[model samples]
Target: MELAEKLFHKSRREKLSSMLDENSLVIVLGSTNVARSYDDGYKFKQNKNFYYLTGFNEPNAVLVLAPGGMEVHDEKSKKIKKTKEILFVQKKDPLRETWVGRRLGYSNVKKELGIDTGMVNSKIGDVVADLISRDKYNKIYISLFDLNFLTGEVKEQLRGFESSWITLSTNVQIMDVNFLLAKMRSVKNEFEIEQVRYASTVTAAGFYNTIQMIKPDMFEYQVQALLEYHYKELGCQDVAFETIVAGGNNTCILHYNTNRNKLKSGDLLLIDSGAEFNYYNGDLTRTVPVNGKFTKEQREVYQIVLDAQYDVIKKIKPGVKLTDLKKYSVERLKKGMQKLGLLKKGFDVTKYTLHGVGHHIGLDTHDAVANKSIGKNDYDKLVAGNIITVEPGIYFPEDAKEIPERYRKIGVRIEDDVLVTKYGGEVLSDSLPKEIEDIEFLMME
Candidate 1:
């Protein structure tokens, strides 16, 4: 890792350490590689929470933090030093590296990751249990993870120690570290904002260049392939999530990733995808005409979603409540649907316009932060440095007999990543061509 990134992670740890109460210990586990099939494993992905703290990208690692410094005996230097952090990583295995990948051995971890002390991860269970048994700390903070999903030498070793660990936990207050990290991650730092902004920029290129190539008779998966190709070509290795390339009636199904169907001439194509830059992610959605010209029905629905999204994005600023934004979005969609004769004045708008207008976007797309309760209160109020998606969608299923035939099976959603600033919301994806005329011109070219 680069010095700048390592330092940034160090600062994050220090900040988190400050948030912890006095005489408390926090333990966070990194992700382990999972087997894909026989004799093979999927690509290893580091835990986002662990990466946020340590910037180490290996499997079966554990991070231990003590708000109050603890004495550590350095085996190499034969000196005793005080430390607030300890990182336990895998021991080097030359044969394993030859078969799989290079290992940043435990001995070199402190120097490489800017961590205080480094030990072989196999000792984590015993080491942690012993620490807890000593009963020096008042509280122990453990990062929450479902044990059934975890697999690794450390996890297996910890499983053996569960009885003792549970016994220790019964005496000390055990806290889930997610809430603290969630609060810290909700507000993006300068580096995080830049990464998210650049991710969006790359995603826009994927959309702009690929959308022009999308024509009738193409399978939905083909469009998904082209978009992902563009993202990787721009140096983004992984997508924020599964690329949704729903076309025709499939567009009405939220989270539809069945990209096998061929797109028809008069149908609309909705591409909801983003790229992950560094660790930050960008999220965006765009609906366009498969034939490069929207029909009268399609344009009306698109305009409604677009206007509702624009209004919601405009309201993103520090101190503004997301609930209020949701309320306003509902009203806008309801009014537009009423004018189109899709609904009566008091009819439930949620039947057509589903989901919250947006969500927090960062390390994980729809980041680990709360989707609705984004504030300190239950109704999350926006705060400066919070980057969220402003997505307003209107869906009319094919089977809905109450709606107009022309509008049936149509889904229109306009989404953009917006940075909540003290000044107001800044559209990180402002460079994208979302205006109807702009989209038409791009497709025509």
Candidate 2:
């Protein structure tokens, strides 16, 4: 079986046993795309939540598990559960296969996906009705919103069952399973970590290729194209997100993705981009001088961002709160700004310093998870095997007249993917040239 298939079964079993009530039925549905016209159609990626649970990457699939029928009494006075994992996938369509590609048919899915049973999608309505017909089940656990494809079918099945109909009239439960899956995916397993590492390696290679091809007169989008081309050449199907190739003052816009400006000799180029592999992503940002060497002011601000990054890395160990790390980066940035005279002595750092120092990185570039509060002792502590990015930046717009002329129109950010560990945080993207001297050397070479 494939690695993704194994992960899918394990995650599904864990979620079913942990989240479902003793006599509840759970249904997980995926999205589908309908044809706009007779000839045109849209492609669909499997829902991340559904894919996490079943590793069924195909569209138009549903997973059903019944908690009541899954339990068995053990001689040791324990109730051993035997949850049935059923996958309903699209039936084999020879015509469609010729146009698109062959799907893992029902028989292949059962053997390869490690599911107890497999059925064609056409039988989903009846199967769901039968599962709800069992009076022992008092509640149904299904994803409430965003799964529009199966909402009507699910509601129809519930309405058809007499017991469910009676319960719905009064107060039968319809529990939402989204939060349960979110919590499960928040933590990274060994396999997930390895996949992220591979993504990071591919992203770093893309960055290297970009550096070699970049010239002062080239457009920012050209640099972006270079990185993306390398990403594809190295096997990444797409970028983790829109590539940020902001030049000069444009870098001040943190989420800048319109890479249209022309690179100049004195301008600093900020490239914040990543590559995705197997749905895992790597986020990396590096600001370099377009002329292959930073001017005095650019170097000063760049070094400060570098120092802030180093400070966060030095203290990022198990048990450190993310909030503390953010505070530490802010303080370091403030101090660095004061040293360069960009900020006045005792000025509030919050006015200039914005955006969080880091975020969880994985399936999504801005991967969703619970965030920690600043100065709060109750915040979640850093744990080993967690993958995150420490991105510290300072943006000074061209119009800002508060500081030296040399420093104006400068935006500097240094980012790297890190793996939290018991001993310390390991920098996964250390291959990128970040140090002032090292960056210059790489550019010149």
Candidate 3:
């Protein structure tokens, strides 16, 4: 990591420490591996909050942050020091190292992660217990997710803190660390924006590649594979979320990921997928005709969704409420649908205009940010550095008798990642074509 990158993590830690009240400690645990089968396990992914604070990747690591300084013995230095931050990492094991990847090893924590103190995780359990029992800190803030999935020495020592890391463990008031982390993660620094931008950039390339290669008779999963190839080919860890390559009637299913159907000439494909770059993610959705040409009815419906999306995106500056934006998009889509005679006075536009206009996209594709629920999302205005998606979709299932045969089984969703700016919204995935003419030209090429 560069100096700026290292400073980013350090500054976040400092800011969080400032947010803490005196006589309190915050404990956050990183993620551990899960077994895919009996022999091997899935890839280890560090908790986003932990990574934000330390940029450390190793699992079974615990981070302890005290508002005021605490005196602790540093094994590597063999000296007593006052520090507010301590990291407990795995001890060195040559055999384990040979089988799995190398550990950061506690001794290198300060140098590598910039934490003030480092200790082997083996002693963390007793250390935490001793501190709590001493009554020095009146409150403890721990990551709720980690508290549930505790393991190793920490779990053994704090065993039964299950009600809260250990059932009836201590008198200290326990609080969740997620609330603070959510508020902090909601905004982006320049580095985080760049991470998402690059991810969106590559993600756009992935869509660009997939749309051109798609043809009648190709399996939907094959298009998914070609799209995911952009993940590895463009320096990404993986797809941030499941690649939704829904075709024909499958497009109406909001969270559909069963990409097994064979594509037909007239059927449209709705792809809502993203790529992960450095944990920050890029979410995008684009619906294109499998035959490389949209019939007149298909073009009309696509235009309605596209125009509504454009109307919503233009209002994305700071101080604008997302819910208001969502409501506005809903109204705009209804008006658009009304023109097609699809939305009448009695009909609910929601049947076709499924989902909100957009959402904040970051560490997770749906992001671990604030105001996830439509009406109650953070209840705060969007400030600059907040990245969001603008996706307005219309889905029409084939069975709907009210719909014309040509427009039935037609679903259109146009999505792009947008960074909320002081001036206006900047589309990060601009490199990928969204205009109907552009898409058709690319397919022709």
List lDDT for all candidates, in order.
0.86, 0.77, 0.85
Ranking of all predicted structures according to TM-score, beginning with the best and ending with the worst: 1, 3, 2
Q: Candidate 2, which segments miss by more than 4 Å at Cα?
A: 1-12, 34-43, 70-83, 148-171, 345-348, 372-379
Ranking of all predicted structures according to lDDT, beginning with the best and ending with the worst = 1, 3, 2
- Higher-TM-score candidate among 1 and 3? 1
- In Å, residue 42's CA in model 3 sits off its true spot by 1.8
Better of 1 and 2 by lDDT: 1
lDDT of 1 by residue, 1-445 (tens): 7888888899999999999887899888889888899988887788898888998988998898999976655656779777789998988999999988898987898789999889888778876766666668878887656344667688876775566656766778878888788888888888789889999999988999999998999999999999999999998988988899999899998899979999999999999999888878888899999989999899999999988888888778888987789889999999998888889656688988889888889898878874456345442878888998999999988888778788887998888999999999999998888888989898994
lDDT of 3 by residue, 263-300 (tens): 98888889999999988899999999999998888888
Q: Which ten residues in a row have the lowest lDDT in candidate 3?
A: 160-169
Q: lDDT tens string, model 2, 1-445?
A: 6866586556656655667777777778776655668978755565666766677777677777775564322222345435466677877899998988777776676578877667666666766665555456677777767444543333344334434445563545777776566556657777788878888888988998788667889999999999999899999888888999999889888999989989988899999999988778999999999989889888888888998999899989988888788888999999888877678766677666678789888777877544454464333577777778999888888887776777888988888999987889998888887889988888895
RMSD (Cα, Å) for all candidates, in order, is 1.9, 5.2, 2.3
Give the better candidate number (2 or 3) by TM-score.
3
Error of 2 at 204 (Å): 1.1
Evaluated against the true structure, the overall lDDT of model 3 is: 0.85
